[model samples]
Target: MVIPETFFAERTSLLKASEIRELLKWVAEGGIISFGGGMPSPATFPRQQIIEAITEGISEHGDKLLQYGTTQGLNELRSELKNFMEWRGINVSNVDDIVVLSGSQQGLDMFGKVFIDEGDVVLMELPAYLAAINAFKLYDPEFVGLKMDDDGIIMDSLESVLKELKSKHKKVKFLYTVPTCQNPTGVTLSVERRKRLLELASEYDFLIIEDDPYSLILYEPIDVAPLKSMDGEGRVTYLSTFSKILSPGLRLGWVLADARLIKKFVLAKQGMDLCTSPLLQYIAYVALKRKVIQENLSKIRGLYKTKRDKMLEALETYFPEGCKWTTPIGGLFIFAWVPERVNTKELIQDCIKKYGIAYVPGQSFFVDESGTNTMRLNFSYPAMDEIEEGIKRLGQAIKERL
Candidate 1:
């Protein structure tokens, strides 16, 4: 079957398979320890609690649960989300500002569809989420990568780029950031930088997409707030999910944006899925209403923190002198850098084939594709023992390569 590649759209050629998802398959086959994918531990799922919630939800609203829902999502779920976000210190002035998504990933796609014109400028962290790069790539955007330090996005670099864009008379569509417990790097944006980010967005008249899935998972008492919380101008489109707090299988997430954009999101999503599942929304609604998701946090936090600690300790003990990594106060990942002489992308196959450990090479996460010496490691899904052994094996692989 020699099917012509021309049969597919031109944009299809731009897409690449996710290494993390591919590595997950190897992890599933068994003994390999996976530091791939932002997957939560199965131990975090409240099976009995979820089962009870599902049973009760169906018993009460079986007909509705089985029926198609509005593209905007369940009203009760949005209502619950409002209160929930309030508890986390993010307050919305109007209920109309909320739109439920299948997951935060959908919000990313829809943002691309509605806002990105071909050649429109989009800003991203140096090493951003690959899935996001894939989603927005389909819309034909000119991506500009932002540099970062421990405080997250470097404001000087951001302003210099903004000035260059202004000189070129180009308007940046949005600056997408993970902010709290960022993916790949696991660095939380500092409070001052967050404030400066909002100020810069206003100064430049560009929107901000705050993709915050890990803020609530913070292990420390950091006072950093979601960019949306401090957004008085309503320039930030905040996206979050129950994937970390509850379960990914439920596939429920929501957006908090200006009503103007919410209207567009509803229209765009209507063509996409018509609606997110009523049944899945019901599951999240039940979890929120019953406080199961909230109550489960302490346990999820404790378990992941222990695993994160173990992995950090292993890195210190086993990794080579030039190796360095972030110590995340919270989040599923610990991003690391090996010596510049070692390319983690080239090293991964050997690590998996010989060392029985798997991780996502950091190159794909970079919009500019420059992170060959880096890799992203996950601590949430792997057991504590796996963390110790996997890191030890990874260390040896790097040492041997060196």
Candidate 2:
């Protein structure tokens, strides 16, 4: 018996399949060089360390590891996370303000569940993280896209948008930002802008959701700090994942927020998954306690930086003039804008079938559906040779279209 469309909730209609994930399916068939998903390099995974950590955790705390954990997560893991955040310059005075998540994706969903109401105004960068736009879209919020310069979100543009929304009597709930080494674009918000952002949040009375998964993966030293660290009013809700720094397969992430907000997130989380796996939490606890994650960062940064440089070189050598891309300080992606007449969405299938390469068309990343001439290329997952060849092929595809 087939279920009718009416059987599904109306909210389900808003859900769209991720282009990057769909591209992965094609890439799995072999032959295609994919610059689609923002996946960490498998070479960077601390396999030996993980094995040791898992063995030690089970031998010492098998009972706890195997059993169910609290909705707020394992206390040991939270304690470790508090220390980790402190090292990153985020002062967590209490572990109660931390809540472990399955991934940062979960934290995004939780934000939608707890805060978003029908038509609530949610601010996002013009070309934001596609996953985030998809996650928040489920809750039916009015997404206002903000402009950005090389330094990340433009303060003037944000202030103007805020004033316009205020004039229209819109209830501005919060601004969701990837802030450091932002996805798709790979631009970090500068320290000056970070301070101004917090000031604007205060002046306009809105919350800031700082999704900071790529801060630790920088290739060059930047003076920027996490927005959460500068947020003195407790208005910033920070979300980060072990996906980049450690392993995405473990699927461990955490939220650093006010205690009251953490309590609410805990309640929402209980209705979602009772708790993130105790086994996984314990593994992360071991990894953090042993400083495995810390020790592995230099290797990850060095390797990805090389890949990033290779991709940039290929883009320069192969990509036709009139095409432009961001020179990221550190991140897995490089977002490019082709000639105005080239709609990447329309060219993607041809690129895959003919060029034997895949990339996420940038349109989906734009909340306002405006980036038709753009594409986001992932440099972390593909090998050095693949990076060069893939950029070459992508260049040819764009050039032919031009």
Candidate 3:
């Protein structure tokens, strides 16, 4: 018997496999130097501390942890998270304003479910996070791409887009951004631009989704602050994860938003997973209470900074003239633009087969279908030698294509 496509939901047709995950499968088979996934370096994980936390938690509270938790999340973890957010300068007046998630990825899906209506305008960066572009697409919203420079989303372009949309009477549902050390591009929104973005949101009467997974991983001392901290009108919904600071395997994340909005997310989440794992939430609480997560951050920042510098050096020495990439101050990726003639999507399979190197092609990250000559490379996962060797192989592939 054969299964028919019609048997599936109509929305299943909109689903597409993540290109980064597909590349990861090839990397798992060996012999590929990967710059595909935004994976944290294993060295950064506080293994001994995590082991101790798990042992202590299970011994002290095994009976409570093994049972199912509340739909909102474990109360102890939520209280700890409130304090954690405060340390980062985000004020949370009550624990009810936060909801733990399976991962920040779940929060993205929840946003689509709770907020989006078909054909509602959802603004995005020119080349935004691929996973976010895919997540919001399932809701059938109209995605409007905004232009960006090194400093991040250009306010002029945003102002123009808002005015044009107003003329057509199209109100944006929300503007989604990975503002600090943004994925795919690694450019941070400047403080001035961040202020202007908030002003524009207020003027246009729209919400802002600030997906901030990389702010804590900054390699340099910058004066930037989380958008949620600056939000006086409660217009920004902030999402962050333990994936960068701790370990991705635990799969824990949280969202801070208005109490009403969090209530909706909790309702939506009840249907999705009922609640995030109680066992994992306990581990995170222990990590925070012991100050293990904070203690490990400096080491993560130092290690990633060295990798970023090495990759930048390799690009300068090996990549051909006219090829350019961002000098990321932090984060796992360095997005690059090859000569206009080289389509990275067409070149990826060949790169994997012949050159033994892998990077995420940039086209899928663009909601507008525009970044054909670009790619995003991860510096945090591969070894130092692999960073240099992979860049050499990638440069050769582009040269041959040219």
Models 1 onward score TM values of 0.98, 0.99, 0.99
Q: lDDT of each prediction vs. the true structure?
A: 0.91, 0.93, 0.94
Per-residue C-alpha lDDT of model 2 across residues 1-402, encoded as one tens digit per residue: 899999999999999888888998987898889999988999999898888877887888899888888999999999999999999999998999999999989999999999999899999998999999999999999999999878999999999999999999886999999998899899999898999999999999999999999999999998988998888999999999999988999999999999889889999999999999998888788789988899999999999999999999999999999999999999899999999999999999899989999999999999989999999999999999999999998999998998
Which pairs of residues have clashing backbones in candidate 2?
Answer: none
Model 1 C-alpha lDDT per residue in residues 11-46, reported as the tens digit of each score: 888788889889989988998999998899999998
Best by lDDT: 3
Residue pairs whose backbone atoms clash in candidate 1: none
Residue-wise C-alpha lDDT for candidate 3, range 179-271, written one tens digit per residue: 999999999999999999999999999999999999989899999999999999999999999999999999999999998999899999999
Deviation in Å, model 3, residue 87 alpha carbon: 1.2
Candidate 2 TM-score, C-alpha based? 0.99
Deviating ranges (above 4 Å) for candidate 1: none
